[model samples]
Target: MSGPTRRPTLRDVAGRAGVSTSTASLVFSGKGPVAPATADRVRAAAAELGFSGPDPLATSLRQGRVGTVAVVVEAPLREAFRDPFALAVLDGLADELEAADRTMLLVAQPADDPVRAVAQLSSQAVDAGVFPLCGIRDNPVVEHLAGRGVPLVGSGSPDGPGMAHVRTDEEAAIGLTTQHVLGLGHTRVAHVSMNLGLRSPTRAARPDDLEAALYLDAAGRLRGFRALAGDAAPVAVAADLTVGSGEEAGRLLLDVPADRRPTAVVCQSDLLAAGVVRAAWALGLRVPQDVSVTGFDGVDLPWLDATLTTVLQPGVEKGRALGRLVRRALEGEPVADVGFPVSLRVGTTTAPPPA
Candidate 1:
């Protein structure tokens, strides 16, 4: 056998069709206008010669538009995607980017090495970047990309640069939730927060607060609760933001004797609140009757019959805003820091403290 017939080339098609090389190039490139008849002849020749088109590498180089956007997350990929709030936001982002025919490159970097992942923007090549606001603080990833003049948009407010930020008003949401508990005539309120670390933004970490480090979101919610209460907000940091942590925190809070116990508990997330409710029931306490409970993030939890009085922050909107920001950055437009609105959803979970 003749070494599997030799591959075809543009020159082969041009010669076979009795057309100039430039004419063949024009026909395939679709740049210059060519007579319809001539174009048809070139196509026919290419088909006969089994020629496809130019190399993809050459085409990409010529276009100079990579169809990829980097989405950097500071948390583990499994945890970030598994969480309902993160999933909703990602879904919204994927929808917008897919509509625009752009691809998303998910980058999960540990808090310690955020730079390694972000450096991919320059080393590898992406049209733009989208990071969660918390991930952008003095983050190495943000610093590298911003240094390279790469366009950036965030799902949350990145502290260093005034990049396009799309996030629900976490402060406002927590404030409303806190006020609800306070309004119910509950003076002794305890907040169960997720641990983000003393280094996280949202809360200006006090030297003493460092002993009870929590995540950035947790810190912010706690700060908001304190600010709204006009008093030092007593907080118990959960090992993490999970139902188990909430349960443990609940037990710890309630063990403080009825007189000293908080009449109401504010959890950082819906999952945490649910855990607290379970803990309360285990202690023979009825929700909102013996002890009131509230959660942040309007996530659905059917098991808890009590309406979860919480903040309805727009998770999908945050994702969409981040996608839009990436598109704007790709188009060479500047993005400004923007904050989304949050609403309070009153549920039966919260009530006036027992007299």
Candidate 2:
């Protein structure tokens, strides 16, 4: 048999088209000026020889870019998708990447073994990485990727060399809602916080937990609530970012003697606030009538009967902000932290505490 069939290369196409391989490459890559007729001839030749474009790996090797970004979320994809805010952030990031002819590879960091993510990504080539959801304060994957010189962007956390962020004032953001309820004459107040630090359990927040927490956003919001609510304010921790955890937290705080119960509960997230609402209803309490509740991150919760009084942090815009930072880094532009501002929305969920 004649040797095994040879795959057609750009050289073969160029030979048939009566053009140089360089000219044929230009036609394929659209990286240089080429006469229309000549470009047509190269395509014809490529078609005749069944030659596809250049090998993507070889092209990336020559171009020094893989056109892939690692999107690291602290939770599993299933859990992340359940949160509307996470979905919007991801949607915005995807929009920016698609416009730039790039792709996103989502990586979920295991709460118990975060280093596992580093090992999984060590062999893959990426132009950059993003932590759209603020991650652990010290992340191994960030260290591994940064060591490899991949540009990094984030909403917050794992911040250092080779990483830029679309910064948010978590402390100030949470304070808006806390201050809102406090302004309404609710003295007996409680705070519901997301888990602080990696692999934290759902329970009452202790002073030590806030001090040693690795998750910066959660810790920051908790501190902000305590700052305005005072040292003796009751605080409960959610197991995760889900509504179920929020409800559990709500039950912990709301299932109490009426005289001792808080008049308002300030939550760290909208999902958590919804849970608190359900818990209140289950206990025969009317929101705003019996208690005023407020949440951070004004995500849409159509399922809930009442609109949440929340801090309006648009998730999609934040994602786009993260994308913009990533794009700048990819272009060799000097990437710097950009501020992301949030405002407060007063909805039906808050009012002067019950008479």
Candidate 3:
């Protein structure tokens, strides 16, 4: 004859368990240690009262901490998760964020998306946001999130106002690679770069019918290559920064008349370099003996028959940097731009170019 069984409140549980509301709250929240017997009594009472727990929304509003980070990317959901560089960078960020007791909310911005997905930004629940290895120029997602006063950090350079950044020193990395190739006494050097467009005047302009458009990674490496090689640098763009792209680039370079072919090829990634080496062998050219190739990224690539002469950037370290930055921003600390240096690993991929 009761209208409907009244929903049990924390007070009902506390009253039934013969404890103060504070004790009942502590036991339920697991924020404090309680005697096993006392905890059991509270649970028993809560079960009898049909009270599961406090409402998450009410609790979040009171505490003002959402405990989630928004990881925003400039690609489709699948592509964002698939790309190796993106994966590595995110792995670093996620590992650190998890260690700090925060969760990740991955959001990918599609290229062909017409209406900016910025309408989805809501700091009403998330602690902060991250943009790893991509830009935010004309990006509504970033604008909306930051406009909502959500603290922001990026795995790469900050693309907008007040966003913290933790990035590898691309300029330094390129300079190191170029110097290494030059050190090998190879004057005819070519760059099989990643997609270009974000960082150069020649970005949107296709290098030729054969080259792919520019990307940020390619632009930074090309900048370094040109700086070191001067006016007569050899460069080509890849449709993508994959091993296949490297091999195709290698074949194309080799097909370039011998007098114009690059004796040393520097690729944007280890995979590309491996491909170039494979393609070179296919053309009956000896690595280092006929053409030297170098790659970026210290990723273990035994598939490459030759030891890649490359630089090892701390992928884990970079991830940790992003994590720390995210944590700092979440804690309301002023996060600044972080730059990690690169180390060179000289492998057998390079020798004096063919006599």
Candidate 4:
């Protein structure tokens, strides 16, 4: 008895169907114009030979395309999607990717052990990789995936060769609000920061934290804040992006003696700013009258009653920029870094120091 029957190949079908190999290939790939009768003959031969088009793996290996992109998010999906800004960015990215006839494979990198993501992604055959947001400056996955010759794109950080970025000047972006409050004559100012270091807790920022910070955006913003607010100005870091974390940070800076309390608070995100507003209300402080607050990312907060003085960086547009970069990189185009623009929008939340 025979060990097994030989598997079918496209060439076998082409030979049996009495058609040129290229014509048979066109019938399967749908890339070129083929006569209906000839296409029917190829399909009939394929059916007779128990063939079902080409093996996807063999096709991809030949074409250097998996037709899928790995979207790496440094936080768990549950935690990452909680932030509206993050959701908007993801939405825009999804839209652009769908239009390109590409599929997105979201890879959530654990906050505690990012290296685990490299292990998980090693088995996946992706055409490209995307960080897509401001995340850890030094990521292990960057080197691992780059070694496999996958093109990479992101908004900031996890930077390296074979990677294109949609750049944002985080320091200058943070300064837009920092300067706004300073211009308003608020001397006793404070800041609420997102996590400066990975897997860190909510607390006051320390010198050690600044040096060891892996999140490039947060570090840049802190540096920008320190540049204007002096080295000794107070900074309370949030545990995460939630309003609760923001509130905790807010109370740290605001729950103090009238003389010691900051007259103004500048937060890193709109969610944090909203929390600060809540914290101020709990402490019986009138916003913009007793204590002014400002936030970054002018994301829409429909439930919040007050407007935030924030840096207007459109998350959707930023995501689209990242997608566009990825598209260009995949098309064998010479990729270069593209700058993403942001502007300041003043609102109801900021004012001069209370006399």
lDDT string, candidate 2, 82-192, tens digits: 999999999999989888889999998867788888887998999999999887888888889988899999888878786889888999999999999988988999999
Give the Cα lDDT of each candidate. 0.74, 0.91, 0.75, 0.90
Model 4 residue 76 lDDT?
A: 88
Q: Which segments of model 1 are wrong by more than 4 Å?
A: 1-56, 118-122, 198-207, 210-216, 303-305
Query: How high is the lDDT of residue 43 in model 2?
Result: 99
The lowest-lDDT stretch of 10 consecutive residues in candidate 2 is 197-206
Point to the candidate with the largest lDDT.
Answer: 2
TM-score of 3: 0.87
Candidate order by lDDT, decreasing, is 2, 4, 3, 1
TM-score of each: 0.82, 0.96, 0.87, 0.91
Candidate 1 lDDT over 168-233, as tens digits, reads 556677988888888889988888776656333222224466335324565567777778765465
Candidate 4, 8-56: lDDT as tens digits: 9999999999998899999999999999999999999999999988888
TM-score of model 2 (CA atoms): 0.96
Q: Candidate 1: what lDDT?
A: 0.74
TM-score-based ranking, best first? 2, 4, 3, 1
Measured with C-alpha atoms, the lDDT of residue 111 in candidate 4 is 64
Give lDDT for model 2. 0.91
Q: Please estimate how well model 4 matches the true structure, expressed as its whole-model Cα lDDT.
A: 0.90
